[model samples]
Target: MALYDVLLALDPSPVVALNRAAAVAMRDGPEAGLALLEELAGARRLRDYHPYLLARADLLHRLGRLPEAAEAYRAALAAAGSEPERTHLRRRLAALAEAGHEV
Candidate 1:
C-alpha cells in the first residue's frame, strides 16, 4: 500500500490511481476504494479499460450494490482484452445472478 502511495505521488496518472484504489480497497475498505474510483470516472484513459471497470464492479459487489455491480461487470466483460478476463467477469456476473441479481 505504501508502494502504491509512492507510485501515485510520483505519477498520479489514471492507471496509477486505479492501482492505488485497489491498494486502498485492501488496506481500508471497498467504500474507500470506490470513492477513489469514482474520482476517476471522468478520466478518459479509464473509459475503455476493463481493469477500472472491474475494480468498480468488485467494490460495488463488496458493498452489496448488486445491480450496479452487475452493470459494471458487464461493461468490464465487454471491454476485456483477454479471454481469461472475460471469463472472470462472466463468473462474477453469474455469481450475482445466482444471488438473485440479474444483470
Candidate 2:
C-alpha cells in the first residue's frame, strides 16, 4: 500500500489510482474504496474505462449499495469490449434485479 502511495504521488496514473483504491478498500473498508473509485469516476480519462465501472460495481455490491452497484454494472456492460464481460455483468445485474431490486 505504501508503495502504491508513493507511485501514485509520482505518477497519479489512473491504473495506479484504481489499484490504490483497491488497497484502501481492503485496508480501510469497502466504503473507503468506493469513495476513491467515485473520485476516479469523475476523471474524463476513465469515462469509457469499463474496469473502473466494474470495480465500483464490485465494491458497491460488497457494501450492499445495490442500486448504485446495478447502475455501475450496467455502465460496465455498455463499455465492455468483449461479449464475455458483458455476459458476466448481465448475470450480476439480473441477479440484483431478481433480488427484488429494480435493477
Best by lDDT: 1
How does candidate 1 fare on TM-score? Answer: 0.93
Query: What is the C-alpha lDDT profile of model 1 across 1-103, one tens digit per residue?
Result: 8898888899989999999999999989999999999999999999989889999999999999999999999999999999999899888988998988888
Global lDDT for candidate 1?
Answer: 0.93
The segments of candidate 1 whose C-alpha lies over 4 angstroms from its true place after superposition are none
Query: Model 2 over residues 1-103: C-alpha lDDT tens digits?
Result: 8999899999998988998999999999999999998888778878889888888999999999899889889999999999999999999999998998878
In model 1, the Cα lDDT at residue 46 comes to 97
Candidates in order have lDDT scores of 0.93, 0.91
- The reply for model 2, stretches above 4 Å from the true place, is none
Give all TM-scores, in the order shown: 0.93, 0.92
